[model samples]
Target: MNPAEQAPSYRGASEHYLSPSRRDPVKVLSEEPVTRRVLTEALAALALPDDRPVDVLDIGSGTADGFSLLTRAADGDPAVVEEARLHYVGLDVDPEMVETAGEQVRSPSASFVHGDVRSGIPGGAFDLYLSCGVPYSHLTRDELVGALRSVLTAVAGRGRRAAVVVDVLGRYSVEWQPNWHLDRWDYAMSFFAGGGSGISEPMTFYDAPALTSVLDEAMAGTGATVVSRTAVDRSVLVGRHTATGTFNPGVPRFRTLVNDLLRDPASVDPADLRFTPATGGAPRDVLDWLAGFAARWNAALQPYTGAGPLDRDAAARLAHALLGLERAGGPGLGVGHSFTTTLVVDPA
Candidate 1:
């Protein structure tokens, strides 16, 4: 067995964070208009038997954030969610996360499971598999490819039209984009202040090509064909999985700037790179979409420091600007570390 199979996932960590609390702002984002719009558009034509219910699995459903949001949406507005019961399984490699998922979170239709997604996924004939927040970057390239294949296979059990939706790093995003920023705060979200005790291999970024290759391999493994694949306004890729092929095109930004810099890093100084400032726009658009696009995060992160979830709104202006950069890549705040990208995948 590979190391991923041996690694215990801390699925409970996420549940603890998302537990019953108005303090759970992340859950708030998961429940917002932006997230729902994305999901609604993504799952529109899957056709999972509206007369009754359908089973959906979040292979790496951290903290039940996505589930909580979906559950609330189903309750808050059942018209969009046609299923009688939204059966869901949230799996993670860590035991604590699974434990937390079970204790908190109120949804009769949902259950938490302890399993390593790095190896083979759980045995369930699920109609939909939802993975959010580009979690695949937590694994190595080989492991990522393997994991994608595993997800498809798990959802494929004895069925012809199983679909898997995932958010991951764009391979084209790796080079010269000032990859790999140190993230202690978010790491603390796991509650392991120093990150887990296990010997961790530091994570890296991917370029566009590598991201595409993983999709190719995943499609081949599931024996599913790609029904749809498109970069949703630069930050997300939405694709439908079928019995033929799948195409995944992750977000791209710094890459466009990197090319410009490579041609002339000296001339690329100052205004060539602009650390986006927080500015507001339509509430329906993702608040952080633009902030995540900045070529450099240091300066852009200033207003966000010492702030909690509620404070993120203060940074909305910055996020709105970054959203513009998403459409037109640029630069800024350059000590070390930069760039954020997202990808989505569905089974054929």
Candidate 2:
């Protein structure tokens, strides 16, 4: 999508975030925790000096959600984070989001500005540059490169070590199996009421190779060298769309069944959670991963199937096993709802 066409509109985004689906068990128990692990690792790598407050720039900072996530991650070590206070600056193109964040995240150390990453990343030399919620997916391939270049340039200019977390839609998510062969598509936020303004917008999806190429191009001659990089997949099977079934209706509602199990094990029928892989245009490796995951996922729920309503203890065990499966699935290969690549850059 062109930069102009990709302008964010949060008309119903707040409402969507407040919806019950947003807090679904899969998200609370699975997605958020996995993402937090990544963020925590990135923060630890920074090893910020205790001299001054850490400056943070959040790209596409929707309602300062990234701020909240970072704060929680830092909260793990209150002495380090509280002593070196976080000075957060969130940038977004949507005015409503900026205003909402300003109102909601009232803090002397935090502020929101109306801007687009494609134009430029403002107020940098930051200790951390964060993007969550697949914000980079809104940009076309070229636009993504430009945005990253801007970030790299800023870090290099300041000649300070920094961390950048790039989150984008995974091209091979089971939620959109039909589009595995394509890098970009019209993605719909179908979890919202009435199918979320009934509009689908063009979004760029990324596999490891494609995203690596973009980052390489962005780093070219930017005077920034990547010290380390880590990539992980979020929501391998229980992505929100898995329950909505808007794109891949043939897939099982793993998200819904998981939520049911989390809320009330007695209300769930284990048979409904069985995963059956379908033939698609995805690469053999991706298909193989899905098949392996499906086998394990099914096995986890097998003992409970037809065992009648599960007791609370049994249900908790199943949930823990499922979450462990997702975490141990290994590095992301675009086989999840969102793929996050964290880069620790040395501005030499």
Cα lDDT computed for each candidate against the true fold: 0.46, 0.82
Model 2 has an lDDT value of 0.82
User: What number of clashing residue pairs does each candidate have, in the order they appear?
Assistant: 38, 0
RMSD (CA, Å), each prediction: 12.6, 2.6
lDDT of 2 by residue, 1-348 (tens): 645356857675765654555666677677777777777788789887666788889898877777776665432443224523888899988777788789888888799998889988786579889898899998999999999999999998897889999999999888988888789889888777433354478999998889999999999989999999999988888888998899998988888877777787887788887888756677777778888888998999898888888888888888888878876644778888999999999986
The list of candidate 2 runs beyond 4 A from truth reads: 1-8, 19-21, 73-84, 193-199, 278-280
Worst 10 residues of 2 by lDDT: 75-84
Flag clash pairs in model 2: none
Candidate 1 positional error at 177, Å: 5.5
Candidate 1, residues 231-251, lDDT tens digits: the string is 332232111100001111222
Best by TM-score: 2
Distance (Å) between predicted and true CA of 21, model 1? Answer: 9.1
Residue 345: error of model 2 in Å?
0.7
